[model samples]
Target chain A: MTDTSLIDTSPQGSTRRSWTFTIGAIVVGLHLVIGLSTLFWTPYDPTAMSGGRLEMPSLAHVAGTDRLGRDLFTLIMIGSRIALIVGTGAIVIGGLIGIAIGLLAAFASRTLDDMLAAGLDILIAFPTLLLAMLIVASSDGASLWTAIVAIGIANSAIVARLTRILAKRVLRMDYITASRISGTSWIGVVAIHILPNIWPTLLVNLALQFGLAVIAEASLSYLGLGTPPPNASWGRLLQEAQGTVYTAPLGAIAPGIALVSLVIGVNLLADGLRDIADPTRRRRR
Target chain B: MSPLLGIESLTIQAGGKPLVSNVSFSVAPGERLGLIGESGSGKSLTALASIGLLPDGLQASGSVLLDGRQVVGARDRDLVPLRGTVAAVVFQEPLTALDPLMTIGRQVGIAVRRRAKRDGHPTDSITVMGEVLDLLDQVSLPQPQRIAEAWPHEVSGGQRQRAAIAMALACKPKLLIADEPTTALDVTTQAEILKLLGQLVRERNMALLFISHDLPVVAGAVDRVVVLRHGSIVEQGPVATVFGQPSHEYTQSLVAAARAFDDALEIAP
Candidate 1:
């Protein structure tokens, strides 16, 4: 048996501050800062067509103006706000409902567990984008919150499935049986024993889901089922910039870069969290 | 007085097939009963049945009485209060018995709080902390304070086993079902754990159901021995009578093997 002193505790506590995690945090943080800042100030009004069309990058117009004569920088900044809202909103809706369903399935009787598993399998078989489109189509018109809700519902099935698998694995451990025999309530068992053991993996999955959420929102907007006109969605920006790409490529390039970078940042954050969650891996590193 | 624990023809079935059939035994308060059986001899199943923790898909048909209360067919709601107070269990694997994410103190504190709640006593942090420390000390762990704060993975195998026992003793249960509690420890650690269990049981006058596959291991710790093979009791008597003059062929063979194991250990060093 390995000596108790040989087991290091710092890896779990310190890995959150590691370089990969720090960089990820910064990337996500900058988008949040830009998103929130846009609520108060922007160089030019994003919705107002009060600038020269297809203007080049200048001191006054950092990213220049779009073909609609709206400030490109202002549009990009507000687009960041839309991305953050949809990403976080979808994640919250999906993660909560998914984890709850998964936990219920895990603790339920064998027949019920099988039923839930079958239902989740059917839900997963449908492509998330197609499911979101069907949901959005049900509404009279496209809107930001509607799109977020649709994407969230689509994301829930995947999250629920993952939670069930991970939670079932934890449930098999002897500690769970011991906890039950110790008279811990079912809720207490999940909170104190099951959750802590399964959180690391669930967290990583949630992070990846967050990244997928951002992309899903962007895709919806690009397909005209997302945030409607007057709101500057990055996907809308991509769509608007496509026509004028030959003349003003930066308009398209800026939102594209933001979308990719934010998703990359979230993925990187998930990787760092995985390392911290498993101390043996952190120690090996 | 009624026995602290009584098993009247306890039978366990899986998928309509009998796995353990009509196994009967009883342990008076403060008496140590050793259940000797091989892996598939239904020893562990009997122990689980005693506490109503049979695995999913296995139906138990029998009466398990603890202090004259029927536990075998009791609902989980009724069993909750009984567990950790009337009776508690220590599983075979110490490594997985204790919650890895929790401190030893916190884990033991849970059992303490549960018992206090059952007795209609309000529990404060100070009382819980004091009780946790006391339980650790009772298990003869080194530096109760240090052990209380340590995680299960941060302790030695012997220490972990001791902590598990402490948790089981937290409720001051009248019956302690130790199911191969020391099977995973080193030879020396095993002996220490067995001794600790024996001393605690004797001091508290708790009924002990010690289940193990090793016959010699049972001999030192129990007053009576029940030998099982293929889910039926082959022979059961006082430890001296069962060991000195076995009546069943299976019991005789088991005794022979146990004696051989002891001889091998003696000649090794």
Candidate 2:
């Protein structure tokens, strides 16, 4: 059942060799490895203030020390971990909630479908960051979990809208009708036919959402609405580095590069997956 | 005695307008009935109504008795399990009828497994695979083993249609409703599929409700014919009486169209 040889491997098999996909995988892999390794060890303790404050890059501290005299490299490593957590957590919550709501809307009767459409329209009109801010504020200041939940909820509206449209299109297919005629239960029809048909498009959308989630977490942290003190996020590191920009430009540059690299990796991956999933597009290319 | 499948005074309304009004028909065991009409003539709607698969907002008010069971107004839970086993359908477009993402084996295996479960038979993977291969073989597909492993898109249109037919017959239904099943195939393939269906229905002693717009095609396969025009049954009787001497204007015109197509084909280089 899990045989790869049984699959139609012409288009998807080549996707891994595409430059964008390969590069994206490399960058994302590096981030994940660094982030996970931080669970056990970093070059120096992330919170310890042993190095001289505002030190330049040197053998003892390769990326140099921060204003608190803690290792900048260690802080960035922990920051990557935070980014991974928020990115994974927010996407899981958003994708699940959004896909479920979308399926409900697609399966609902005409009147209820209209109501859900209208409600989704209203939600989509509300900017995600603004909604996240409101949620965070309502939850009484930022923490790691609160920021993740807020971002997740905010991101869910977009995913729900996309899922509703994709699922509706899938439900209209003749195979879906045939599946129903074959006595497949509604849930079985959804699981076997509807979900698989809509998955490629939804996956591409979710990948794009992952990049946005990382950026949203960073923005929230920058605004002092994410991962409150004692933990370093890439966004928080940027915030802490802003005061000493001229003296230590690497402080701002390092986290900025890291943030941009991760987002780029995700976007490239989405592009590659989109090409592979849509065979017509892949053929044209 | 009640027929194997029956419909009486079936009226389908969409947005307060009747699409199919006051239509009635029935098929007994081993009967081959043809439903012939032009597009939008409610020929397909009647079949869809029988299967309880009418689209949303389209309401049907009447009696549909399948194997002595009331299908019209039956809950989906009741209709769902009754479908495929009681009365299976072969849709016109084979490409869209089969799931593109799944292998032909997997799709056929699902139907086989459902039938197995209903019959209280063992449903191990090997048994399912053997059943799937047997179904593919029953449809006269070349290389049943390779065909089972192939995806729907990997097979030709005719093969796909055969695969669809195999899946439909997996449950060994009492009545098989084929709605324009061969419309998408080539002339030769169409004839072969019609012959295959005729042979299978005879061998299994299953009732067949064969729907098509072609009169000659209907003549070739069915024992009786029902002509529909603008949501009404124009004329219906034994195929010999209807085709040999069509009474209604609609039936005569349909027969004329079919004759003209045949004449044109004969004249082609």
Q: Pick the candidate with the highest lDDT.
A: 2
Residues A68-103, candidate 1, lDDT per residue (tens digit)? 788988888888899888888988999999999999
Model 1: lDDT of residue A70: 89
The candidate that wins on DockQ is 2
> In candidate 2, what are the lDDT values of residues B38-114, reduced to their tens digit?
89999999999998999999999999998889988999999998898888889899888888778889998999998
TM-score against truth, every candidate: 0.94, 0.94
| lDDT measured at residue B243 in model 2 versus the true structure, 0 to 100 | 94
TM for candidate 2 is 0.94
Candidate 1 structure quality by residue, lDDT tens digits, B1-269:
78988999999999989999999999998889999988999999888888788888999998899778898778988887677777888888887888776778988898888888778877898988998899999999878887887767767888888888888888788989999988999889999999999999999999899999877789999999999999999999999999999999998898898889879999997
* Candidate 2: Cα lDDT at B146: 86
Q: Candidate 2 i-RMS (Å)? A: 4.2
> Candidate 2 overall Cα lDDT vs. reference?
0.88
